[model samples]
Target: MTAPLSRRSLLGLVGAGAGAYLLGGCSGDDSSDDPDAPQTINWWHIQNTEPMLPVWAAMAEEYRGAHSNVTIEIQPLENEAFKAKLTTATQAGSPPDLFQSWGGGVLKQQLDAGLVKDLTDDVKPWVDGLLPASLQPYTIDGRIYGIPFDVGMVGFWYNKDLFSQAGITETPTTWAGVLDTVRKLKAAGTVPIALAGKDKWPVHNYWAYLAMRIGGLGALQQAAKDGNFDTPDFVAAGERLKELADLQPFQPGFLGAEYGSPDGQAAIMGNGGAAMELMGQWAPSMQASSSTSKKGIGDKLGFFTFPTVEGGKGNATDAFGGGNGFAVGKDAPAATIDFLKFLLTADNQRTSAKTGAVLPTVKEAVDAVTDANNKTVAETLASATGFQLYLDQAYPPAVGQQVNDSVAELVAGSKTPAQIVKDITQVAKSQ
Candidate 1:
């Protein structure tokens, strides 16, 4: 039940948990007049914020300072738009020198299409130092291809204040316990959980966790990759989600809520409108970004592995998450490769951790995380007994999209488990 140290981890988490991707230069051509001077390394990422932006900018600046000849240009893009644009750009052979990518089938698609550079030799030193599971997804056909900059997982982020108010002393670790807590919280006039289904991908997180909890990692992977959506295991997992929904567990109108919004699902938990949230470690930053949003947010935000169902094949410690990092494009210039190595150094990894991105890949850098919450995240991932790449990311691109739409339909109460399975089975068959 050890976390699958397979090639799916890197791709699964990013596509499932975050809705962004690094594409080609959105402006137009590379436009570097230095045909023989120095390579202009282009980086596409979505963390274009105050502190996050400054950190990446500094890394770029410092990288340029050291390399002297190379210039790193970071272009930020809107999440959904970037993914679409990147897909188009990559197809047209205009991919950036090195761009950010989510792990799993997303990266695999590019790998299958020969759009990304194979970095087996380049990543040897880092690979030797990484935990096996962490390195699995970035590698293909025995060659490493990408570097993990930052990685994190999704779990139950709970408001301790809300829990105490509901007379709940222990964090729930089983399906029954989760139900009990929801009932108690409701009696106390608080919604038990907050979930944002509007973005669709966030909804897939719950489905993946529940499927892993019920069927185990290997089964989920097989079903996801093969489109075996009709299995009893998948149906059982869908039922668990419905169980939570039946309890009136989610915040009011959560189905239509915004995702990645500080005031969305996390906001519901932050304001005491809900007792807990099924969200990633990034929830804190969103919660703390605004003055009003900071009301009940605290170090007391307790976390627990997604609860398990009795007799489920998946173990309690098996969690869902992955990493996103830069990989050289197939047509990258030699100078760009040199610049990329500079960005992957231990020092830069440490700087990225300080930006609130959880669990950086560098051994030395992640070891230096002083924040208790960050430390907990590192421990949780390390201690996990089993893991699965997020379902959508683990499957083919077409299947991934179908899974997202299926889960969204299930959550919206428009599709039954049987119908969803049949629908996805067709998608899987087509692939």
Candidate 2:
């Protein structure tokens, strides 16, 4: 389930640089001219695969069966495809009535353009029923614009058997220990880490986590505040990542590896070709699906939160990740939210959890998570002292892309740690 919060104690962690913005929703005639009139909702999502795809379809069909007056048209596209088409649609000002949202600077950009609805009033009645940390990424400047269905953090997903083979007894809790583990794994003839370098974005995960570990959440918020990413903390993050890079710990030909390809990072992890990977909650399933046998590592898989840097400002419990949510477009019919509410019910969330793909955002549905590795993630997130969305989603597109690009080069040995920070700062300033 989502990052557990004891009721709403964590809501005060409104996140960094998330100061103030005048709340406003785009003005449009409500599609429902009559309260119970026939309605049609256009929905877009990126869950274009089995388990989730059919799960969403079943929910929509169930809603249609119950409410004969409603018609929901869903377009489940591939991740990059959804982003491309959504960009084109938003540019044309005709987005779907209900669409997917990751909730960060991207959502903020949509709001600033008056493209999405302000859900503060609409969701207030039951918003608190969900985990406060789950709502953090979707909350901006004191306003709620979207509702997350799943929330989690990025951490080390390791093969327990491989660790045991390497004679490692426990997961590392500090940066120095992690490096030692990597070296030990290498000494044991194991690939220390599985990275998708060709994809670029995946490798950036390490640098982002390092930034959080070294600088703390406020540094990130302050960087966003001043539009500057050239700080000692950030540079130090790059250097630390470079230390890992210099160890040559990634899988062979990792520089050309894709994430989901037959021989890519996930497959490497699933097939036990590597010791570990830095990834999100979905890694296990991705590894399973990409592996030759499609059975993955089974019970041999384990999860661990990112380690702390000895004297870093960030807490050991500050999580770095994000999740998927739904945003009601400005022009949506009243029935749109009615359907959304139906889909998010505790029973439905449990149904989603059983599929092993989603981490339910509803606090009451936490028990539905039964997988051992998933439960560990749920517990880790539940105890997180702070949360950070993925940098690619948390920052504006240009800046996020630059971070990915520069970090990839850093890992590829084309750019030094100093060069990457300088490069990212330039792009951030341009933004």
Candidate 3:
């Protein structure tokens, strides 16, 4: 099977597929003439925990107060739960009026089924005010299908104190330097890294970054197109990952650690039990929530982009990450889109940024990022030369899941570098 359409190819197919449909067969009337007319918007988001949970509630309240005719029914669910619930709803031919979306393969599936609305015209007025890269994943076939609130990349979140203790003066810029840093940390009797092996996605990041560094962004796209990942470059990525794993750099019992649990990877770093972790922009907030003091490591933390591998084709500035956004259901009311627009205003985005929950997509609101670590991440993302969405979101579900599974096996030493690529190729071909 061929891979899912890339952002570029998908943009070419917009407007040629299906005509836009209004929610509940309602016309685009705002009901301003009839103040008594009621409009209810069903919203599903995965920010079930604080400080975002309350932040979202307040935003909705403010919107409702201004527009008495509109009532927003918000359902906040955990990340995995939201995915399962959304799947069931979409498959049943009913999705939330506006719900959380990552806007890649899954969004494409919904679009193919005519379950989501094309928001090109709805968001065009202010879409340009947001970072272009932040909109990449949401813009399909030259049409806007979602609106991004947060955008960031995956990188190393390290403890400055630990690095200083290890006697390292600078962050590593190459794979060899990374290994050397790990050795230094080990020599100083500290955990070099924190990993949540129980969550396969975190482990997959290492392999994904390695693949991009060794083979370049085109390599992944070409492999996906050809349904073959068992190439020399792919194997080399796995081998490089193995080299790191062989050093036994991760914290004790990392093979069984969870991602956001009390003793998970984030917690380890937050509690200062480990020196570093490779994670996305939300890492700091997660660390804070999971830490014993509920304050994380604070200013002790520093962000650095993923290092390059010598002889690699990828540039060091190439980013690998994704962000959160909202997808409007095909039958969503006109007011639903309006509420979405309200949520993305510079003022509202800045409000969200102040909570340290998001790296605002609106260019003007980026200055509201008060957390120093998050600011560094945002600036790095702003200057990135290239970007690749998370592999699980970039590819079809089957292929993405298989990538995670195979990479986890490689990390566990149950599969060889070559075998990992072979297994992934098998899954991709079957899809």
Candidate 4:
């Protein structure tokens, strides 16, 4: 189970044991030697809804117009659909020329199967121009396999009016303060938080962030390396989450709710049913769409980084989140890489950001994040001292599923904090 890596190597230990399940694809010679040679590139992404959908279509159209000899075939699928389709394609030794990638253990798996291109040389000189933190998740084994168009972090997305109603003038900056704020918000008759226990992945975030804040990034890597998560700091994080759980701060039936259902976490936040939710950068748009009004809180929405843990080794700058990017397939033509670069340009990044659906990975495009909530996410990412991909995406499938299961039980009051840690350790050791 032990693996050697560099830099953010401590993160995204995916598919270390699944190598036997993957088959190698044929080495591609479909690429053209002439830069302007006529070719068709297959592009796949998972932005299937409005705002982003039309935006991508326009970008492809623009690219086609610029390169008259090039024909672009674009396919936009929903998130789950894309994953299923990609799994089928890669298993058959065929994948789109360029497709979406989240760049953690998943990227590691793709690389292991020789399904991805090594972009280190192709993107060099210019890749360094992107933000340092934004590049962390995409880099594996000291090489770049993908390019990030957006980068983000997880934090508290709150409603200004609800906070004001609860007499919370400022967002909590420490764990203790957050506990107090939740107490106040609950006392004021507002559901302090919204959670989706049915979707165990979201339940994992609280435990993950608390552990990062208390144990620091090294502690996580150390556990991952040694297959031991039964430590004081990890237990202490679960204890703190238990403290909040004891307050009964979440909306009723939270244990059964889904992430995007009518009564889900985002809907509760959008309809002002809950005071806040701990979510990623896409929280705002999802909330708006899922809300009954389709016009979420609008200006009433705000965001703040996860609170610091008092006396903890980590600070607010250590972030926990992942973002979207494009990875070149092994069979992709050289022109496919060029198209990816064109899509990530600063000017083009600005266009994507203006849709209020993305936060640019390129430093020059940060200014395009004019929405107040989005700007906060971008600023927080800009100052990140450390990063960890989402636990589900960062670890092997069996281990990640175990993490989600253990966390969900803890949230549901079925497992003790200590028991949860031991459960995770057992799964990691088995892996």
Tens digits of per-residue lDDT for model 1, 1-431? 00111111221112212333322222323445454455566677655433355576676777666655565667765344456678798889778777766556677889888888888876665566655676665767677777766666777788888899889999987988888999999999987888766667767777778888888897776875566779988888888887777777777778887544555664666565667876665655544542254434777677787888898998888878766667778877666766666766778777767755445777778766766776787799888887666566567777777877887888888998778777888998898
Better of 2 and 4 by TM-score: 2
Q: After superposition, how far is residue 399 of candidate 2 from its true place, in Å?
A: 1.2
Cand. 1 TM to true fold = 0.88
Which 10-residue window of candidate 4 scores lowest in summed lDDT? Answer: 1-10
* Cα-based TM-score, every candidate: 0.88, 0.90, 0.90, 0.86
lDDT of 3 by residue, 215-310 (tens): 999998898688899999999999999999999999988889877678988789989999988888778887887789989989899988899999
- Ranked by lDDT from best down, the candidates are 3, 2, 4, 1
Q: Where does model 1 exceed 4 Å of error?
A: 1-36, 270-272, 290-296
lDDT of 1 at 324: 60
Worst 10 residues of 1 by lDDT: 1-10
The whole-model C-alpha lDDT of candidate 1 against the native structure comes to 0.67
- Per residue, candidate 2 scores C-alpha lDDT tens digits across 12-75 of 1001111112112222335557856767788887665545776888898888778766777777
The lDDT values for all models are 0.67, 0.78, 0.80, 0.77
Best by lDDT: 3
In candidate 1, how many clashes are counted? 7
How many angstroms is residue 131 displaced in model 2 relative to the true structure, after the best TM-score fit?
0.7
